[model samples]
Target chain A: MTETEQRAGTRPIRVLIGKPGLDGHDRGAKIVARALRDAGMEVIYTGLHQTPEEIVEAALQEDVDVVGLSILSGAHLTLVPAVIDLLQAQNMGDVVVVVGGIIPEEDAEELKKLGVKAVFGPGTETDEIVRFTRASVGRA
Target chain B: MSLGQEILRGDRRALARALTLVESDPHAADDIIAEVYPHTGHGIVVGVTGAPGVGKSTLVDRLAGQFLARGRKVGILAVDPSSPFTGGALLGDRVRMEGRGSDVFMRSLATRGHLGGLARATPRAIQLLQAFGKDLILLETVGAGQSEVDIMGFADTTIVVVVPGLGDDVQAFKAGILEIGDIFVVNKSDRPGADQTMRELRQMLHLGPQRTWLPPVLSAQAQQEIGVAEIADAILRHSEVRLTDPEQRQRRMQEAERLVRDALADQLVRGVVSRSQADGRWNEVLAEVAERRLDPAGAARALHLEQD
Candidate 1:
């Protein structure tokens, strides 16, 4: 049997990497996707300029355990809430949403209060992201 | 209502959830299909494929839009490859398509770790769409490759897109794509060498084979809406060709063969893995092979892997 036909040896955790709004910056998303994969997670990346609806649809279709949003467009406050609302509408509010990118330190706490599991800002290492996903997804 | 009933009743949200079940969990998908199978087989399915950077997404966007213009509900199943190494994938084809609408149901799928998933989950997704009342389905796959070829087996008509300037011709395509394409489209035909590319395709068609159905070489500038109507006409014309009884039988046989092969392979792996703990030596045998102490073929024989 091909590697794909057989399930992964461990049912590797699945993560959806999303870019919301018109930001168009995917360098961080791609890097985080690579990092998460290196940590043995199956990552589904929805390419840049995705709407909140598209991101939520992808998360549902992929059956991802975590939804990681990369927002550098200063639109996180709007974009993140949109995703959260849709995920809840889809009965997936508990799907562990995480955010990464340029965020004001003050907005980070607001995001967490809005149910973002965690946030990674500038100068954050991929390893830290990987560790966070492992522990968070593993528990969630 | 049950998922199957919802799907048969043309519930869009139910159909989406059913497709998700199929893409992620084969066991659950099987149950859903068992209930909905009889209601499927209504939609005309088309496979659109080509190398990346060929504007395939744009062409399909136009193709599906035209079908919508004709009032047919369209379901687009776009497959993007996942990195075999990290199991990470970027599925973005739908980004270029005209945004969602009431009559259109579009889903972008990542290959998830299945060898031929481009073909496997696709038929099931198509069936859900068919059951959900889509009159036409477009199965879009990533560029030319073995998986793309394997995935073509599920379609009623296959449209292979080739752009002019990226540099490859009929001879290059002849390696394999020429045989499978029901319609060869020169997308981005507004670019230089559009006519030259079309002529090369025609000349190559003349030399390829003698058959009742001659796959047409058409030009399309999808972004500008140039020649899309002709390309659509060719696709519709090709799909209209009736299959001879013998040809019909052959097609069914091929589909059955592939289905059986995939099922058997899946079952074989499941059985062996499930029985390994009871067998006691499964890991030891694997270790022996991994260490090269026993060849894989010999180890398999020892395990009676082929006795069935």
Candidate 2:
């Protein structure tokens, strides 16, 4: 086992990076998935155009610690909170939901109000995302 | 109450956390397991293994759905090999079970580059799920490999899924998988040569060693959900019969013993192997062994795993 694994009660932190919209863009999600993986977290990436229900269902099935929603198609407000509502409905309120991609400042604050943990808008560094994720979920 | 107590009380988050802990630090998870083991042994552990593309996932999904329809809870632990370069995995097995509601708790675990965890943590995962009140747990292996037989240790019933027309008669009856399968299933049975494949399997079972269970050969067209209930019944039958069988207990105990022994040995030598790699001693030793210039056993003994 690695040193981190040697720690009692520590498992590899699991993150689900998903895109929940009709927008076919997925580069942001894939990039963030790679970053999380490089940071030694287990990442499950859902490819383009996933329904909020499918995404939330996957989160429950995978038992992910955090979910990163990638939305570039101006649907963050509707799609992001819809995922949050579904997660909450399934008693998965503890799962930290994050967002990345193009979003207006107003929408990012609205997402925060909707219980998104953190948001990475345009020109954010991958390392920043990794660090924030590690800090948010803590070790494992 | 302890985490184990929470798990026994059917706390979903606690169960998920336990699986995560087991995947990363199995040695540590042993402590929690010791606390909760008495609450276990109720649920049936089913092992599903086969070569890739054998429809193991699809069959398992449908099988789990059947259990759900009966108001029984099911858990699935899907194992996939981690990428050597990235140490990350794309666990796509959950895709098949995506819409299947919350009654089924499924998680995908990377093999983490060890043949041992498939044998070790798999049982522990099943135990945790069992304690969480699951009626059945399906453990799907990482395709199939020589070590995949280790799944038999944890499962009360092991279903080896095979598809027709993969190859000729000789290729189909490779002794490695044939020997360990508790139940041989010819999946995609609606296709051509399905009966012929079943016939070959029966012949192989006849030629192979006889055991307490004759290892029933069955068929399933998983896509259409045909013959699933019979397979489910077969699983239940095997699990029920094996409960009181001392031989089954002995086999499981022996498997547990080997896993502990191997895990300790691996931990002991892992640092030494890393040091050898860093110091350029690994390849040199391998080359010497390959050339017969150095006795592999002697070389292993000479380089102490722990430098005293």
Candidate 3:
């Protein structure tokens, strides 16, 4: 482990997990949250029905290492871009932002180009999420 | 000036500064973490999740106190709900944890409409705390809804809190809360139906396949502080069990990978679109799509294909 990992051995990786827009299907989001927690990262999950502004503001206030967005309503194009824009407008381009839930491969590429660090579709192994986040946050 | 560096050096003041930067300037926070990337990964992250009205805040308060008493510096990241109308946070967790604020490093973050019971800046804040020499970090989510359960992904040990008298076995199971718990906590144990809840949880646990690690369901009265010590112990125990399992570690790494990939995609896609929009390409394409001159897929393809 690196020095950061050594230090983090005593502290947890903090992440802000959110579900943006009106997507009511949160089962996958919740499962991922639990999986991340089980893997030793601190998670702050924003409840459902959040606007883009609220998501950005929460990210600002929480000071999280990573931001995970879960959406299953096929609104990834509109909502995801809006969130990325809000974060960038707020000068938060570096906080790792990821999205999950029912995203198609095509949309995933679009989201990736929009500065989403990662996109996990359904059946994404929980362990994959933990690994990517740990690495992204430099814990790995 | 780099919060990540300051955190690595265990500077409390610097850690605070870093958290502030993360909360306001996430881009800057990223630079900070990049600088200090080599010095993280040594903390125990605990997540406390449960249904609403289960006194989760109170339980967190007591648990933090316990860690403080043990001489471990604690970092508490409490995720609060945002106001629907104002887009601001009510942030009630801070008020609930008023007394412990001075002792432990405590910060309450409003979810601010981020779904899944998570706040956006929470990860950066935890890094700051780790850099500040906090040995243990406690992340208390809003409540045990599906969104709240999703937030559990951030914890090394997850304690799913429930209350007695909520409902019968069917109701409890219907909530689907059973599947997410690593350690089941029946808070409000002093209530009349506490034992019944505990028994039901235990029965459910046994009915499941015999895994290497079987989650334990314990009772607690967060208001009275009853079983708080046991709850803490259970969390620690779960952590130990998790640590020993190589499969668990692998699973965690994989999950982290998914999170990172998804985040990267989100960031990159947004960047490309924004840059294109700034150059008037986005609007032009949208207009073309709207006028039936080009298909949406074709427009998207042209936009990205041109970049490559």
**Which number leads on lDDT?**
2
Candidate 1, residue A94: lDDT: 66
- Using alpha carbons, what is the TM-score of model 3? 0.64
Between prediction 1 and prediction 3, the one with superior lDDT is 1
lDDT of 3 by residue, B190-295 (tens): 8898888889889888888788879888888877878989988887788788778879878778767965885698578767786777788887888899999999
Q: Write the per-residue lDDT of candidate 2 for residues A2-109, one digit (tens) a residue.
A: 332343224567888887888887877777887778776778776677889888877876789899999988988889989999999889999999999998898889
Question: Clashes in model 1: which pairs?
Answer: A4-B113, B50-B143
TM-score of each: 0.84, 0.78, 0.64
Model 1 CA deviation exceeding 4 Å by range: A1-14, A22-24, A37-44, A47-49, A61-63, B9-21, B101-103, B112-120, B145-147, B168-171, B243-246, B284-308
Q: How well is each residue in A45-94 modelled by candidate 1, as lDDT tens digits?
A: 76788889878876765567899999999999999999999999988876
lDDT of 3 at B99: 45
Model 1 docking tier (incorrect/acceptable/medium/high): acceptable
Candidate 3: Cα lDDT at B97: 53
For model 2, the superposed segments whose C-alpha errors exceed 4 Å read A1-11, A19-40, A45-61, A70-75, A85-94, A100-109, A117-140, B116-120, B145-147, B244-246, B252-308
* Candidate number with the higher TM-score (2 or 3): 2
| Number of the candidate with higher TM-score, 1 or 3 | 1
Worst 10 residues of 2 chain B by lDDT: B112-121
1 against 2, candidate with superior lDDT: 2
lDDT of 2 by residue, B1-308 (tens): 77888888887778877887787777667778998888887777888998889998899998898877767789888887765555666666765654665578887887766673263467688888888888788989988634577776677788989888987755856767788788989999988899999998998898877777788999998878998988988887887678767786787778679767876886777767677767777777778889999998867865564344
